[model samples]
Target: MRMHRIGAAMAAFATFAVFTLATAGAALADTAVKFALDWKFEGPSAPYFVAIDKGYYKAEGLDVTVDTGPGSVAGIGRVAAGTYPLGFFDINSLVKFRDQNPDKAVKAVLMVYDRPPFAIVTVARTGIAKPKDLEGRILGAPAPDGAYAQWKAFVKENGIDAAKVTIENVGFPVREPMLANGDVDAITGFSFSSYFNLQLRGVKPEDIKVMLMADYGLVLYGNAIMVNPEFAAANPEVVARFVRATIKGMQDTVKDPDSAIDSVMKRNETADRATELARLKMAIRDNIATPWVMANGFGAVDPARLAASIDQIAVTYEFTNRPKPEDVFTAEYLPAAADRMLK
Candidate 1:
C-alpha cells in the first residue's frame, strides 16, 4: 500500500511540474506593452478596449495596457519621453513636437483620424455663423485643448482678426458648461465631443453649430498611434503586432459601434451609453471612415495631402527644422491594406 501511494504521489508531482513550466513559458512569451491614450476612455477610445477584451493583443503575443492621458499633446510627450512605449495622440501635435524636440525620435505609425476633428462649436443663440463671426465674440478654449492649439492657424486661414476675439482660457470640465449657460459664445473642441456634450447638457441639436476645421482651412491630420523610437527599433515585430491588433479593434468598432461602446462603458462607469454611442458613430462618419480612408485603406495617409498639411502648419508655426512627411510618419509598422480596411 505504501509503495502504491508513493507511485501516485510521484505522478501527481510530475504533472504539477509540467503545468508550472508551461505557465512560465506562456508568461515569458507574452510581451508587456504600456499604451497611452490622448484622452479619457470615451466612445472614440472604445476600440482599444475592444482589442483588449477580444484578446487581439494577446493573440499577437502582446500584453497591452491602455491608460488615459491628459491631452493629445501630453500623450505625445509621454511616448517621446519613453514613459510609454506606444501612444495615441494628435498627429499635428506630434509634428510640432518633433520640430520642437528634434533630438527625440518619435514618429506616428498609424493614422487613425484621417480627417481632423478640430472645430469651433457654438449655439444659435451665439449667432456665430462663420469664422469671421468669431471676431468680437467670447470664445471659451481650454489652454491644453488640441483644437485651441490650432486657433492661430484657423484665425489666419479664415481671415479672422485674432485680437478682436476674446479668448477665455477655460477648464475642460467647464468648457461645454460655460457655452451651454451662455457665459461663452463658442468653444474650441472636437466636433463629436463638444457637440454631443452640449446636447447632454440640454442644448438642442438644431441650435448647435459645428464649424469643423477641416471644413475651414486647417488641412491637418487629427490623431495617430506613435511609438518610442528606441523601443520600436529594438522590437520591430512587437510594434507591427501592436498595430495589427489595433487595426482589428478599429475594424470591429466600425462594424458594430454599439457593441464597441459596451467595451468603453465597462471601463468608464460614468460614460452614458447613448451619448458615447452617438460620439462613436459621429467619429466614424466625420473623422475615421472618411471618403479618403474608404477609397484607400485605413491606417495610412496620403503623402501629397500630408505635404500640403505640413505647409499649412508652417503658416502659423515657425519650425526650426521642417520635417518631411516621412520624418513625421511611417507605414512600415502597419499591416497590409487588406488587414486595415474598415467596413
Candidate 2:
C-alpha cells in the first residue's frame, strides 16, 4: 500500500508539470499583429473597432493594433514590406499592385464590404439624371486610381465623352461642399456616406440623384482584408482565427447597427457624432444589407464575381499584368459564423 501511494503521487506531479509547460508554450505563441486601415476611422471600418472593443482579438489570443494610413496603396505596400502584418484596403487597388509588380506576393484573405460604394451624387436641382448628363459637367473625383478607373470606365461604357467631363481631384472631405456650392456639378461619393451627409445638410432624398456604379455593371469588391503571402502560408491558423473574429464582429454590427455606431464613434477622436451616426446608419442599410451581400453571405466572395471584376479591370485599365483571379482572394478564411446565421 505504501509503494502504491508513492507511485500515484509521482504520477500526479508529472501531469502537473506537463500541464504548466503546455500552458506557457501557448502563452508564448500568442503573437501581436498590427493592422493598417486604408482610411480614417469611420463607419466602413466600424466592425474592426467593434471586434477590438468586444475583446474578439483578445479572445483569439492576439494582441492587435489597428492604425489608419494615407490610402489603400500605401497600406498594401507597408504590409508587403512586413511593416504591417495585416491591412484593410480597396480590392481594385490590390489588383493594380499585382499588375504593377507581379513578383510581389500578396493576397486578400477576406472582403469586408462586398459591394462597391462608388456613386455619382448630384443635387436634385442640377437635373443630372443619367450618366449622359455628366457630359460637359465638372465632376469631383477621388484620385487617378481604383474608383476613378471605374468612374472612367462607366463614362466610356455609356458612350459619354470623357473629355466632355472635367475631372477634379477634390479629395474625400470636400466632395459634398463642392457639390453644394456648385463648384462641381457632381462628385464621386460613397453611396452610404454622401447620401446621409446630404440629408443631414437638408437635401431630401427626392431632391438628389445618385448614379451607383454597381448599377452600371461596375460590381467590384472594396475594403478587403489582405495578408502577406508568406505570412498566410506559414500562419494559416492565426489568419483563420483573425478572419473568424472579424466576421463575428461584422455580424454583431449588422444585428445592432445603432450600438455599433456608438462603438465606432468612441474610437474617433475628431469624429462628429451626428455625421458619423448618419453615415454609419446609411452604410449599413445601403452598402451592407444589399442583395449581393445578403445572398452570398456577408464578406463572402464568389469566384465568378471576382472573375468579372478582373476582366473589367483588364479591359478598362489596360492592366494586362493583373494577378489570376484565384490568387487575389481566398474564401477559406471566412468565418463559419456567417454560415450559421444563414441557417
Each prediction's TM-score against the native? Answer: 0.91, 0.85
Cα lDDT tens digits for candidate 2, 1-343 = 9999999999999999999999998877757888898878887778888888898877898777889887755688887877887898778878878888788778898887677777888997778998899898898887843556687568756888888899999877777877877788888867766777677667777887878787776768777899987787888888888887777777788887778877777878687777776677667766666776777676668788899888777756777686888778887777764452433
| lDDT (10s digit) by residue, model 1, range 1-343 | 9999999999999999999999999877989999999888999998899999999999999989989997888778889889999999998888888888889979999999999899999999978899999988999999888898888989888999999999999999999999999999999999998998899899999999999999987779989999999999999999999999999998899889989999999999987889889999999988998888888778999999899989888876899988889999999998888877875
- Collision pairs in model 2: none
Q: Which ten-residue region of model 1 has the weakest summed lDDT?
A: 334-343
The number of the candidate with the highest lDDT is 1
Candidate 2: where are CA atoms >4 Å away? 1-29, 171-173, 193-207, 337-343
Error of 2 at 107 (Å): 0.8
Q: Hey, what RMSD does candidate 1 come out at?
A: 3.4
